[model samples]
Target chain A: MDKRMSIDEVVERIPNGATVAIGGSSISRKPMALVRALARSDRRDLTVIVDVGGPDVDLLLGTGRVAEVIYAFVGFEVLGLAPHFRRARQSQAIRFQEWTEYTVMAGLDAKIKRIPFMPTHATLGTDVLRVNPSFREINDPFGEETLVAVPALKPDVALIHVNYADIQGNGVILGDGHVDVLCAKAAKETFMSCERILSSEELQRFGRDVQILRVYSRGVVEIPWGAHPTGCAPDYRTDLRHLQDYLKAASSEEGWRQYESEFVDVDHPQYLTNHGGPEELVSRLKV
Target chain B: MPLMSEFSVDEVIITTMARQLKGEVLVSSVTAFGSLAAHLAKRLYAPDLAVLSTPESGMDVTPMPTLTLGQFLTDVQQGIPLTMEDIFDAIFTDHFRIWINPSQIDQYGNTNITCIGDWSRPKVALVGARGIPEDTSHLSETFYYILNHSPRSVVQHVDFRSGAGNGESRQHLGPHGAPTTLVTDLGVFDFRGPQGQMTIKSLHPGVSLEEVQERTGFPIGGGEGDILSTPPPTADDIRLIREADPLEVRKLELMSGPMAAEKFVNIYERERQTLHATYPRVGKLGRG
Candidate 1:
């Protein structure tokens, strides 16, 4: 079965008011192309779960498509606070469900394992338990202690980016998977976009620990420079200059409109061209 | 900007944090200003502190002021990549010391980063439960380096439980101990009592024990009514911080306003570039 789909078709499957878990490290390996496509689409009222939120949350909030954000921390790292996210937060325009890095990790892990909830000692005596009803303290029948139970987060979809993948959906990431692999397993469906799509033989040559098997992938989009602005390790570095510009432009509604028009409104080819072509990105990868 | 006639409040806070790390080798997890205090402590006092500013920043000997992908790649280039996967051993096995800022803390040292009021509907929404939750119950040791020393922050009970402490730690954290030290703008607190409860260790210079009690939401424990003046930052501490942060980026950590968050981001970018050039990459990754 050919599990290959266009970016639009993959994004089209995500309905309005759906919950999505995005896979990436802060300032790295983000599915920028897919995020942009979703922003430009008619989708609305999205609920996002990310460990460290950056432009993914910022853009959706900027476009007024996001209704809530579930996050551990949300910042652009050195690039600064995510402008749209910060404003929305200050204005109380959206609801926020805060989880610790581990809570989100364990929540997704439980979902993947098809468990109702996972037991953890985290957030047991902390202030986090007061607000989130999803996290409950239950007696560890086996361990003789009370622990926090993190309910499974079975997201509707998981939008992920990897360095290399095959049309069949098997993929390889050059760097740390973080909770990306877990997100893929937790979601009902996972759509991947890769920098380069290799054959099954090629994926086998590179081998395990680095590979994400086709079994987890529902569909794969072979889009080069898919994780633009933010980077894919070994493939390219973060487009820092463009990101700085985004930080400034996203601070205001007017500035974000210009950014939204020039960058987000266009399709993949035009988007790559507007970013000074794939060749320019290739040149920026000296590090 | 607290109008320090003789010395600023950070001097005492940073010194206390550095002093805690003295004579110990620790793998620490910190963010923003806490990283600075930990770095300074390692540079001047600890000498065996490994700070994981970011997973990509890995376990660098001397943590850089700004953590960038370039710096991360360089660190990765220097040795095998120390990614999030590596954190398992660091947190559970090797036991990384934790340095964090809690929005709300109770008498037992239980922390809450989730929200301020009721959990269902919060009065104020701050950063969510992150590292403190899991690490609080698992890490070898935990420390709170908070800036706000007010009733709103030092509460009788935290609205949410983000990191476990006190009897809760004994129940949930297992063999990994609970928090031992707390360094705030008001004073240094020690939890090494018969029962693990926060007590005023020493008041900052010019601060009265009464002032601390007046601000704290809970009944002040341990020191009772008589706590000594915390030793002010030595000349070396002040000199090291000044030389390290010429623009005083440390001031941003103290700001309470919304606009300060924006300015902090801008300042961070500008400072990161300049500071990355000078960050001392001391010995190898494993050595620290």
Candidate 2:
């Protein structure tokens, strides 16, 4: 009856080569604990669906757990490129499907709506038609105009981190959650890591719009500071210094290994201790 | 004294980009280095301009420098925000113009941010077509900024079509306009030449017409037609820019070779303001 599990336990359920989508925008509020767990594990050949992804994609790509990346863009926000992802792409070690925000959203909407495909004008005049075969161009039935029909994206699993969740797996998203809701709705299996494990009644204190409900989520875990370094807005700010350090470390193999060892090699409990645990983050929360 | 003298390449490009935003568009959005130019335009010339400051920043009343994701969060914390849906809808509405940076631009005005080789696969992988599809094909006006211009970037045919220009595949595509201006380190280019291929509207101060053609992957401005050149930025423009981008973080993205000894003073003074008080000295430089 209880859906709560440890970070490692939830990640263990994801098989190698699974197509997974991680929530949050670019560098903001990523599911870093779950991501770190996946990286630490022996999972291989993952295809990550991401928009505005930073370390979520870069860390997995660096660890060689990724086979492909589906992204609108993946860079270090403004600190330049995602070093590990860029290195892998330059060597052709990775495969990617370049998409716009609309194409990816449309793809997810198809699965959420249980439709075969979603038609959009996003790729009508662009080279996305040629670059990605995942979408097909067909003439509109009512008119002569060309419309692109993007295939549905039903990832094998979704790894999302939210600010709050109940033991039964309802989640509370705090800020500008770009496509996380659609991602959860579209994903076949959804695993979440949250800052707090609240009661179903406590979740009601939030207005109806924030919660992602138990039906869409498969499992949830309570891991304080779970999305550290990456901002969990309405909670702690993005640890800029930590992100900068990671950026520097990721630029080289030796540095990345050191960073991975320092952060990812440990369990969620141990990792939380290194980052001043839950108390420090509690005071920083905007709410 | 000449109003247009003793300005750096960075200032010229900034002014050129700022002027491009001068027309009647109520809102302007720019990505990467283009945002700094947009910021300057709002302060200096286009006081009425509303900027979608960062990539995530939609219509904000104030122009805060959100050069990073962290700053973007700050904007959201303090400002009235736009949802991802609203931002995308605005692209189709045609009220605002977008200024984007392209990895490769073809003669017909098509741009590519997809992989540099065969679609099946090969060569360098660039940042995929994020907004190029919507911005290039749907927005009212779209301009481009190329930091490093060379034969590889200005090509005959892009390896994969990320943004549609005036190519054969886009002939029937309507409601999509070609880019208004293609500003680069070398010069400002447009698609006014025969058959809508790129041609030189104006060459930069130090650059030559022959050099531009030689470096271009496709032919431009020669048999196509006579090329025109515009005057460089005035001293007043330089002062405005120096005050605007006090941090001179943009210099890293645009400055080539060296500016004279005096240009160093502006860069140092502005950078110091951030290094000392705004942020820890080490944190402020690349942080912006």
Query: DockQ for all models, in order?
Result: 0.35, 0.33
RMSD of each: 5.7, 6.0
Q: Which portions of model 2 show Cα errors greater than 4 Å?
A: A1-4, A87-95, A163-175, A195-215, A233-256, A272-287, B1-6, B22-32, B44-48, B70-77, B205-207, B222-240, B255-288
Cα lDDT computed for each candidate against the true fold: 0.73, 0.72
Point to the candidate with the largest TM-score: 2
The window of 10 residues in a row where model 2 chain A has the poorest summed lDDT is A278-287
Summarize candidate 2's per-residue lDDT along B26-45 as a digit string, tens digits.
Answer: 45443435666676677677
Interface RMSD of 2: 6.6
Candidate 1 residue-wise lDDT at A255: 88
Q: Ignoring the other chain, what TM-score does chain B have in each prediction? A: 0.83, 0.79
- Predicted complex 2: CAPRI docking category: acceptable
TM-score of model 2 (CA atoms): 0.82
Candidate 1 structure quality by residue, lDDT tens digits, B1-288:
123555677766877777777544345444556656777788777786766545534465455444333334333344334655466546655346756778888888888765566655556545556677767767666778788889988888887777787865565556464877888988888776566878878878778877888999987776665667777777788887777666566676676444664665466456544534554333221242
